[model samples]
Target: MIDWARVGELVDEIGAEDFEEVVELFLLEVDGAISALEAAAGNAVIVEEQMHFLKGAALNLGFEALAQLCLKGEKAAASGRADVVGLDEVRQIYRSSRLQFERDLPDRLAA
Candidate 1:
């Protein structure tokens, strides 16, 4: 299950007035990065670069699960494990996490 208390804490840290806009922007960027990483999985360098970007972005946004997955993908890509299956798994996890984040965002912002 998602940690909504952590989400609330993050929003409070970032300032409630700007929380919604920032969350929306982060989600949009993360979604696009996930797509790019999926499409570039055949190229190890590209995949690694995308994962690195995603890792930092997720971490900064306090998206712990997404950050962890991106770190795992980065490690795998760095070690030359940029296979289709691995990329697909990352994409699926990203999608699931994104959905959960969206579902809980309203409450976080309201707080």
Candidate 2:
């Protein structure tokens, strides 16, 4: 669900200070994207767009669970199965992963 190795690599690539800043941006941006996704519920086109954007962002940040959920939702939206997409699960997974990243990122960066 979470890709700690990728996260570590990102921290290393960007340096700790920049990595922290990037993480903050990711959290804030994804929070807004998730809210947009929730609000787009029942609208397949909007849902697909929201999920597609979120998927890319989540992948970059190693939010694997959220990315996977977004991928699923995006595919479903494309197939006109948007109603079957689990928005709640997406939200839950995102929240859990976000919390995990927030809690562990500093330590990981320090390491």
Candidate 3:
């Protein structure tokens, strides 16, 4: 879920303080997106848009698993199939990924 190398590179590119800011912003945005996605359950149109945005954000932050899950959700939504992607599982994964990033980012930035 967490890509340490990418995190390191991000920190190097953005500087530690800016990296933290970006992480915080990402968390805030993604949390909202997750909520929107949950509320959009069974709504293929909304789900597709939400999942697409979330997936792109996740990829930028190196949340590979979350991004892949979102990709699945996006495709399923595009196909008009609700059963293919589990929103609950996606939510859980997002929460786990958020927690892991919050816990690990400091040390990673310090490094």
| Per-model TM values vs. the true structure | 0.76, 0.89, 0.89
lDDT of 3 by residue, 1-111 (tens): 987787777778998889878988998999898788778758889889988999998988889899999999899889997557787888889889888988887776666
Q: Candidate 3, which segments miss by more than 4 Å at Cα? A: none
Candidate 1's residue-wise lDDT over 1-111, tens digit each? Answer: 345676677677877777767777877887788788767847878888888888887776666777787787788778888663366666676677778877877766665
- The full ranking of all candidates by lDDT, starting with the best, is 3, 2, 1
List model 2 lDDT by residue over 1-111, tens digit each. 789898888877998789878888888888897788778758889888888988998988899988988998899998887776677888889889988987886787667
Model 2 pairs whose backbones collide: none
Model 1: per-residue Cα lDDT at residue 33:
81
Model 3 Cα shift for residue 37 (angstroms): 1.2
Candidate 1: worst-modelled 10 consecutive residues by lDDT: 82-91
Clashes of 2: 0
User: lDDT scores for all predictions?
Assistant: 0.74, 0.84, 0.85
Poorly placed runs, candidate 1 (over 4 Å) = 1-6, 108-111
Clashing pairs in 1: none
Please give the lDDT score for candidate 2. 0.84
